[model samples]
Target: MGHLRQIFLFLVSIFIISTSYSQIEISGQVFDDQDEKLIGATVMVSKDSVSSILAYGISDANGKFKIAVNNESDVLFLKVSYIGFGTFKKTIQNKAQTLEVKLSPSSESLKEVIVKSEILRQRGDTLSFSIAAFKGKNDRVIADVLKKIPGIHIRPNGQILYKNEPIQKYYIEGLDLLEGRYNLANNNLSVEAVSKVEILENHQLVRVLDSLEFSDRASINIRLKKDITLSATATAGIGAAPLLWQTKVTPMIFTKKQQAIVTYQSNNTGTDVSGEISNFTIKYAGVNFDIDKKDWLSIQKVLVPPFSPERWLDNNVHLGSVNILQRI
Candidate 1:
């Protein structure tokens, strides 16, 4: 029994040695038709186009590749391919050899491509306006450019309107950073940093009620330039009469992961920057009244002027606001 087992093992070893010697190693150099070495070219050996790959190699920086195929097929197919070049294929015998393959550029010609830009386009319920088309050379802030866009309007008090109606929501890159107080962003954001403005008509503020409830109100979204992630605006002035001074500093950041805006404005010139912080979305949400004792209850208090507060009030005012929103 031991002699029989030794004979079987010896036969297995001979079969493995013969299989190792039968493998055919092929080395090749790939080059373009101009005789330039083509690096990262693919060299594959197979029995036929539909057959499984017998061996594969990728040309190195020197355009040299080595592939060993252990197939016993009498005829083998060698294929070499590279980007923008015609594939080279040839049938060869299963033998050890060297190859010098040259590939030619594809003969096909691509059609001419024409890129046309639109000032405004409407898709479904959304309207997109290109800022470059509407923005004037004199436009400093985004609000000035927004005013130039047809069908959109800006009120004297910094309220944005669409077709004589107010927008339900305001978003900077799809984020509600300032929530209802979007005037701070609309009046302060630079025009150069904005790329496009999109309006969502019949916008449903609540996602859950999108299909259930239909709204006629619209929403405005601002898309910033790709390179503009951080922006700031600072203005300071001193006048001669009454030692008048006004200064404002606003810094903002808008990115995919987060959005933040901080502003500090003080003026004795009656610029009324505090109006930017007032929530203008009161119409959408239920309103609550705040009764002041001096104004509401006291009857003998100094009679309030009918004109705007900025015109009657002659005092220094300072306003500070910070808004931030982060994605979890």
Candidate 2:
């Protein structure tokens, strides 16, 4: 029994020596054509028979990779692939235990990836929409063009909604042309002058607190064409008998460092032009300050029944407003 046990131990030691000799450790470094280390690159070793993968590893941040192969007799092939880079394949001989691979940039792969129907594209925190893709023949003004955008809607009251939420700020060339009353520019601005519309989501209004503060609101910016630095819109109409007339003139100028918009609107057709005026009064802030006596007097008197103010106030209503914005 002692002699048999000695023989069994000798055979087991030989088997372990042979197994260790057959196994080989492979190490390599991957780099780009510019000699920059490529992280997360796939390094694979497969049998020359094209059967199964023998070993695999991913390049680390230092572009170093290590793999192990258990079969030393089988001829192997190494493959390395990464995004925006060309694939590399080479035969691994029995004596070659270390490798260094440099992958070239794949321009052919980039050409094959063509984006033909991309109307909206996102970059960082801003989303840009191509104007030509959304504009139509009947889109005479910017308001008309905005209605055709997928995630944007223009209400009947000229309010702008983005993804079902109202936009907080409207900008022209990175300048807030209208403080809170942006309907003036949206309704009157010409669509032909605009080249693109950018939506800044989760925008931070205050520049100093941008990193510390966060907001859910979004802001819109209009990018005009290169040659369209100056644009204007004018409308004039007249009717006989009752002498009904309306006139609107808007002129705008946009530049890299300065922006200005001047508008004059006058109508007597019962249009509510009070929206153009800046009213800082908040209904829910619990601060009661009445600047207009007529407003308080109307609220104090209880009416007989709820009625449509539009029907009751059928009289001629003359409204004239002038708004000018200049940023330097």
Top candidate (lDDT): 1
- Which candidate wins on TM-score? 1
Worst 10 residues of 1 by lDDT: 110-119
Query: What is the C-alpha lDDT profile of model 2 across 244-328, one tens digit per residue?
Result: 6667777877777666667777766445555544331223363323221213334455473465454443345444455555544
Local distance difference test, per candidate?
A: 0.79, 0.70
Across 210-313, the per-residue lDDT of candidate 1 in tens digits comes to 99999888889998987448888899999976698889999998889888899999988767776778666644255322211112244476887887766777
How big is the positional error of residue 64 in model 1, measured in Å on the Cα after superposition?
A: 60
TM-score of each: 0.58, 0.54
Give lDDT for model 1.
Answer: 0.79
Off by over 4 Å in 1: 1-116, 283-312
